[model samples]
Target: MKYILDFDIAAVCISCITLFLFYERKQRRFGPGESYGRIAWTVLLSSVFSAASSYFANALPGTSGAATMATVTLFYLFHNSIAFFAAVYILNYGGLLPVKKTMRVLLALPWAIAIAAVASNPITRLISYVDSANVYRRGPLFFILYLLSTLYFLIIIAALFFKRSHYRKSHQRAFLAAALAPVLAALIQGFNRGLMLECFGASVSALLALITIQNASELMDGQSGLYHRESFIEFLAGAFKKKEPFTVLIAHSPELADLQGSLEMQNYRALVAQVSKWMFQASGAGAAPSWVGTGVFGLLFSRRLKSNPVGDLALKILDLADASWSVGSLHVKVPFKVTILQCPEDAADISDVVDCIDQIAEVARHSAHKKIYTKFDFSVGKHKRSSAVAAALERCLERESPELFYQPVYSIARSKPFALEVLLGLSLVNNEQAFQSEVLSTAEKMGVSRQLTELTLKKAFEWHAANKQELAGIDQLQLRLVSSMCLDLDWPRTVLKTAADARMDLSKVCFEITETTVSRFGNDLAMNMELLTGKGVSFALDDFGSGYTNLVKLAPMPFSIIKFDKKIIQPGLQSNKGRQLLEGMVDIFKRRECAVAAEGVETEAQAGMLALMNFDHLQGYLFGKPMSGQRIVEALKNG
Candidate 1:
């Protein structure tokens, strides 16, 4: 070989060795892919075949020249064929190759034919011939086959190159470049014999070495340094494989996108990255950390610890990362919440970890200010108390444990009761105190908020049905329908059907919806309300001005009654601005042929004020606290 060629070959060999060493190191630090394993086997196989072919070529002198040439040709063919398969395997594993079976078969056919041809050709005359000088000289067919194989390899590498280019991560590109270098070198060598191809191989090996070094550095830094979802999943798998009793801590920066658009995005991202680093460090003890999503980071541990890992990590993150970073000087701080999943206790597989993290992220997204961390509790009891309140609410439904109390709405002009607004009361079975908001919120969560609303409506309807003769003079009864239940298709249909079967006068029953429910459900409220109102049932917007009420929602909905929320009426009955807005709303409702009821009239002054403001009805503790049917009946009779 010429000096340059010798140097080139030495460089190629060195590159291959470097790549092999790097591959070994990476396999140790991370895990190996099936394709990596196959490629390694192929490299070993190709090297053996190349050596055998070179030896046979050198040996084909004078005696059995044809057979020696043929053996050498066969070895070359087998080596190249296996190389093609290795390329195919790598591309397929990387999801770069077409997955269609037909496409794969078509791609493999050429290499398969070449292998078959070489195995069948006993004389090897197709690729080489023994000249009278007893030297094995290449035939035209040999060059053609070489060109064909080289072109095939080039096509495969090109496909992978294009595929890798689409990926955003720098590490992924480096990995792909490392994997493709050998194939590119082999292709260059097939077309020309000189130092160029060998130089290419050396350069490729150097790049592969860089990839290994960079990844190792990242691993040492406790960062998987893989910026792709695939890498995170692989890391998770390894964590499970090692049977590490680790907790997966998921932190979501809900305002990430918003921050990105703001002036503070750069600083915000830096803060988040810093927090992520601290969180990983705080997790400590064989914790394999990765950024699983744009806003999510995951940590895998080898053993479960007694300490509250999530809380500790969260505090560290809050300390290191500016938890108070604001966007655009708006003083709006993004909420950061963390969820911890301990191995075996939280999940047994990577998928379970992912799911738990997602669930926690959802919870975190809804968390109030400063409520930053939560743990995945599998105990049916714990979740029911916290996240799964709705799930356990079925027990409450069976007992009909919720009671209905009525507050009378009195007509201001006649000084007579016009309607009674029904409210839900949940007295716990064990005399345990529970938040009314929680009971209702749990019902909403459990998807039984509608059921509870319907139950309240049913009890009120039953009371009215039995007392219709005694209260025959009364024109209407206002029953509070949770705005959530009004949005519930099933519950509304069932309630309406039950009301229809009872032959209850629809005009006498006014369905009231709370302001909070209206804001939460929004346009979702319209459909259920329309269904009931179309049946002659009057609808009331209860607790107006307390939620995101606007003239727009009221204008479109068939609200025959508007009940001012207590917040709007209390401490504001005397305020001119408050009264003006209320009066304006009442005026708007009155123009639409609606009656307005003022709620929370604690004093005769408040009532007198409301009566003068043209409120059609008034209600409050001043009139009566929500009382039992008997008390309401007595109050009506006495008045």
Candidate 2:
């Protein structure tokens, strides 16, 4: 009885201390619940009851079996009640249990039943016995019932401990150890004279003390580290859930292969690790640096830290690392750029933060300067314009927003519009600005240029199909083909099949290929052109004089028409060298039985000069700027 009193007091003291420490860690790890102080109060109340039951059982004086039965029953009920609550706590803290009324009811059921049974007269007597010295000893059935209850409680605690271990975050192992200590101790005490349980509890206390010391050492070393992704996500979610402003700075290294080639591979990795360490130190006293990918690091901090602090921190770290990278023999010294997106400033979701950073990284890659960081700027007019253009293009698939514009290609000898050059005009929605020329470049970078070109061609075909009479009047309608589109075998094959399905005349469609497209795509050009020409579609060389154009390059290719670049024609009317080059190009095309067209003539003089040089077509502002099909028909009527 004397030892029982000591054991009860010690158990109560240890329980209170552990619970207090657990809660303190929980607050630092996870914030308060919606009920504010309710969780802590409930846990404290359960501990008090457990402590009280232990005290009363030790203090009770009676050899009467009925009184001993009553004491053991109360103690068992109190212990089980706390066990149930601890299970619920672990599940909730691990994020396995949802915070709902139904979940709360389910978690509270075991505790409620235990409380009711302890208060009931019949069950209490059935569960306990009194020994000869007025001491409480469990009955034969008591051992069985206690074993089952203990096993069940230990199973719950063990399940939670293992489940949480997989997370492997800071303090998770220590928390698991703390939760497991009492369960292991109780299992030992059930067989032995409570000696092992007491020793285990003391050992756990020592281990916890050691952990605290290690944490303090890490803190002194300026390392507040998190080892898993879930912890980072939970941390961010907590900050965002509370509507607290924060910033997420994502630093992406150049591709590892790219970096590896720049310097010795080992040296590069060492440099990266050093930079990562520096980033954590610079971010804050408690910043956790996470390596999200081989070359990507994520640092999350409170927005109240400073104004544009991520940018400043990134620059400072880069400067200190002194990253001098060499690719082959070329020495390139630069800092890694940091892209920052603010929480509740840029987006509410973590996924959106990731996407915004990805877009910023893409923009940074194309930017010319090195070591320059970019923040997500929703107000950038250029980005808005590009988005509007992409949206308008999407709408074009459903409605006729894109119209066909035609430029007349006149026959100098015939003095008539022999061929029509089809141009694409996108109808802007509302006050939406059209895409700049770089929009096409952007699409190419996004791997959608071929699709955009095919869409344009399809729109042209749809227009031609609707206006058979206008198309029939023209000797030929020339459509400018993007070189990239020709290189796409699947797209070109699809276009051919579509044209065949529509019963469109391939002879009426003259595809003008830019010289650069031919140069870039090379032999694929020759092969695709040969297939289309075999299908009775004529091909012309567009932008002839520009883009590394050489006679040697043009001699072996099959082209029905040769169009002089605007650069050659614009100055040829006044410059002798330009005039000679224009005449020479025309003569060469004539000898090859290819018609020649002069582009960009703006005056009657330029037009007359082109006509005199035996150009088969005169295409420029002098005749008319590219206009809609209806306007072209009206021009034809007026002329």
Candidate 3:
């Protein structure tokens, strides 16, 4: 009865190592990880018991009878449970089981029966027992338990096969090997009884499962420790396919860019991780938290154990966000814009849900205040319009057919055109109502703002080259830079190269930056402006008085022109106080030797008022509306 313990010893060592690796990963366990964790624990314990059982059973007549029986009973208890736990893991991993207590209890029935039989084996001597000689022997009911265990393995294999389409190829292979390796070895040992391969099979299965299924880096953000965007989207898609009721809450941080710019890279990552942990804890059971995009986090509560209290969770999150967060010697406030959407009610399919999330995230990025949005508050029309524009933008950029319009900036001093502003002639609807801001913002989201800028510059410079003889009176060609391009460090050199390629005079180019973009600019923007300004290009602070205008802050940036926002000029024409303010602003700019332009001037009185205020330039409907390059050139020729 002396059995070779080579396989049992090897299994014990391998399972111990596998279990150590599983726990050492320290991943935030999603549903599949939790189930696989159970399997890891079960397989490791089963291997230990299997090795001990072999030692006692091999000693035969020399081993203590009671001691042998106890070890043998524990071995059967743990060894027979591996298949049952594996089956449960498979069900959970495949999303076959709902997150319900009742369903879980039903799923545990077979394992419960196996545990009961094994626990009572000493008295009944049904499944396994130790003889008087202290040798382990199978009882009459041994095959019954073995058959039940084999049934569980069969179910795992079948589930893996039938659900193959639902999983990636790698997942299918890993799950199949996990189910088949153990059962095949067990079946061989069940017939021969000499080869102790059962535990070895379990160890192999555990190792395979842990390596493939428990690798979190594939599905999670390395910094935030939350599921990545694709993983989160796939989870939602699966839940939707199952018709599982669910709600998603998106938390977008408007200050994320500011935080990134302020903090060191490591410190910034720590801040993101802290925020991610807080969001994850607030989500209820069966909830999955994901880092959907930069500055955007999504919490999906699917098949939740209880009702989805997403609204309260969002409110609580915002309340917490109101306070300052302490991260690595920095006390910073991370503002959030929260929105909740329910499946089948708010979104019809995965595409709809993705589109809605994208558009909402975009809105949240620019929103100034913290607020909450319910399903009813989400604008379906806005989402549809933005989505359409985004799609059209992609096509328009690829085809290089986006329209460009030119508007003249009138010189009040000389009573003629001083500059021609290049504008993107983009519209959201067929009516051709201007949506250049929306188009530019969408281009930023799509990572094509730089492309749009390049295309506009190429077309404008080429048109100017083609119509060099048309009036020959334009002093400057003004091109507005979007926020994304302004933040890019390479923009200065790249734009100069673009201009050089077009053979355009650098002295005649004026780059317009909006007032809001000024606050977000860092040293890189200043350096970029210096580089371009060194090349004889002028810079204009566009849309002044529209936002928090700090003249002292603008003093160091080397802006040569300040354009008054329409909101500023309209009021200046109506009231004495407004006129005084306008005149004072104009006088300050003039003293600094910076030319001032009044934008949005439309009437004779408004034009006269701006002229009296000592505005050097005027641009509005009163001067000229945005028209085609050809028409604009023809008008300049006729005038």
Per-prediction TM-score, please?
0.45, 0.52, 0.52
Choose the strongest candidate by lDDT.
Answer: 3
lDDT tens per residue, model 2, 1-639: 332334445544654564565445432332212221233334334344444444544665633456445444555554554455445544544555545669767666656755565566345544555546666554444444444445446646565556765333655555566556666766677675534243234334333633542232332222113223444555565566556787777666564425657677657655555555566567753444555544566677776654656767766755743665444455455455566666776666655554544455455567636554544432224444455566666676556355567888877777777888887655556664353244456556666666676666676666667777755667777887775686666555866876766667787889888888877877667777788788888989988877787667677678999888887678677888878877887887899999888888788877878878888888888777888778887787677
Each candidate's number of clashing pairs is 1, 2, 0
TM-score of 3: 0.52
The whole-model lDDT of each prediction reads: 0.61, 0.60, 0.79
Q: Of 2 and 3, which scores higher on lDDT? A: 3
Error of 1 at 459 (Å): 2.8
TM-score-best of 1 and 3: 3
Instruction: Write model 3 residue lDDT over 1-639, tens digit each, in one string.
Output: 556678988988998788677666554356445666677777777777777777877777786777777877788788878888888767767776556779778767777788888899999999877876556788888777777787777777777777776567888889888888987887788687778898898889888877787777798889788888988876776667566677777877768756878789988998898888888777743477888887788777764646657777888878866777788888888877788777778876666666656676556545555387655545555656667788778878888987888899999878899899888866545554445677888898889998898888888887887787783798899988888777667878777788788887888889999877888885567778888899899999999998997777687787899999998789778989988988998999998899999889899888888888888899999989999888998898889
Per-residue lDDT value at 197 in model 2: 44
The residue-by-residue lDDT of candidate 1 on 468-497, one tens digit each, is 987776777776666566554566668767
Which residue pairs collide in model 3, if any?
A: none
